[model samples]
Target: MNGKEALTPREFLRIADFFATNGYRLGPKIGEGTYSKVRIAERSNNGEFLAVKIIDKRIAKKSYVTKFLPRELEIAVLVKHPNVICTYEILHQGELVYIIMDYAERGDLLQLIQTCGGVSEKEAKRMFKEMAEAVKYLHNLGIAHRDLKCENILIMRDKRIALSDFGFSRLYLDQQHGDVTSKTYCGSRAYASPELLRGAPYDPRTNDVWSLGVILFIMICGKMPFDDRNLKLMLKKQMSEGVTVPETVKTQVSSECVRLVYQILDPNTDSRPGVVDILQSDWLN
Candidate 1:
């Protein structure tokens, strides 16, 4: 099925019925969002587990989902990288939209960080490398994930990372320009780039790099580098003072890691390293 195409309610039901007939079993709910609920499901034929995200069409139509869903589905289906969550199928039934995806048994990075306080530098380096690889793959495909945060990074049972949640992603290319910039200011406040916080037009790719820096910081420090509750103060700090690695973290984390964080989180987007540079950094190597 071409996920990029719009589907009618009747067509959606037909697709859902096909999947049901093909032995997809929806199980207990595993997570929930404003207009969607995620459940564990089993593919009867192979007994493989998957996550089924069911979205309420009624609510989705009134939210950002109405505009982002198509692109989200398209990118999910097209991007196939080891570090990216796999979108197996998309179905619809009446007022509900279903997205079948690979199940990450170990939950997300946020949950792990909250449970264990934080990860060791060695572990954080491995996870960050995987994330950088995934981001490089997306950028190569002319795509940019605007919302790259710890909560959106899933940990697989094998200890690898899978980047998920493409709801705010966008293509950076246009037919005429080949590459373009974005002005949308949508993402977690704490992870947002300085330009985004300032309501200025920004390059989505660099914006993602900033978020990755924030995620890395959280992974090692167990706290946000920027304060989301106080937007004005956070913006001022980000633009003028830049991110500060607490003396405690500085003592624990490697100097290379600290240098990378500062480089990635630079207030001037132009100074921030691209995903490729990050992937090739000595710390990641």
Candidate 2:
């Protein structure tokens, strides 16, 4: 259906039927969102695993953006990279929309951080490198993963990282210069860039760098560098006072790494370094 159109009740039933025919044995719910619940599942033939993101068309049709679920699937399925969590199949039955994707057994980056009581200096750098590689791949495809928070970065069983969740991703035409200039404030408040919070034109790469900077800090410090009671205060702090890696962290990681973090999290997007700069940094390479 188009943005303005709605699916009928019969369409919803067909969507559910599609899943049953796909050989996906739905397991327990693993994640929940506004209109969907992600479930653990296995493909019947080879028993290869997958995560099934099932959304009720009825619930979505009545929600804001009523069309966001379908749009997200469309964009996600088009993006394929080794470091990116690939959307393998889409099953539309009745009023249900199902996205079957590779299952990351290790969960997300947040869980990995917690597993180590926060990552070590070496681990953080390695994680940063992997993340940079994935982001670079997306950028090359002319896609921007606007939401690059810890939760959106999944870790595979073998310890590799895969960027997931393309609900906020966008394709940047050459003329756009990679700017997320449109009025699209579409990510978690904690990781959002200043321009995003300020409601102005901004570059998505810089926005991603800002969030990655935060993740790097968290990985080393074992905590949020900026803690505020409210979103307003958080934005104020993020704008006025950029993160300062504690002296203790300096003992954990190199000065060059610290400098890299500061460069990325800089409140001003104009001065924020891009992924290329990060890849070229001694701390990264």
The number of the candidate with the highest TM-score is 1
Worst ten-residue run, lDDT, model 2? 61-70
TM-scores for candidates 1 onward, in order: 0.91, 0.88
- Measured by TM-score, how close is model 1 to the native structure? 0.91
For 1-285, candidate 2 gives per-residue lDDT tens digits of: 333224466854554455557776666668767667787887778777789887666665453345445457767888877788989888766576778898999999888777877887777787789899889888877777888888888988888888988877777555646344546788886787887888876778778888888888888888876774587887888877777888978887889988888888899877888888889998986
| Model 1: lDDT to the true structure | 0.85
What value of lDDT does candidate 2 attain over all alpha carbons? 0.78
lDDT for residue 212 in candidate 1, whole number 0-100: 95
Clashes of 2: 11
What is the C-alpha local distance difference test score of each model?
Answer: 0.85, 0.78
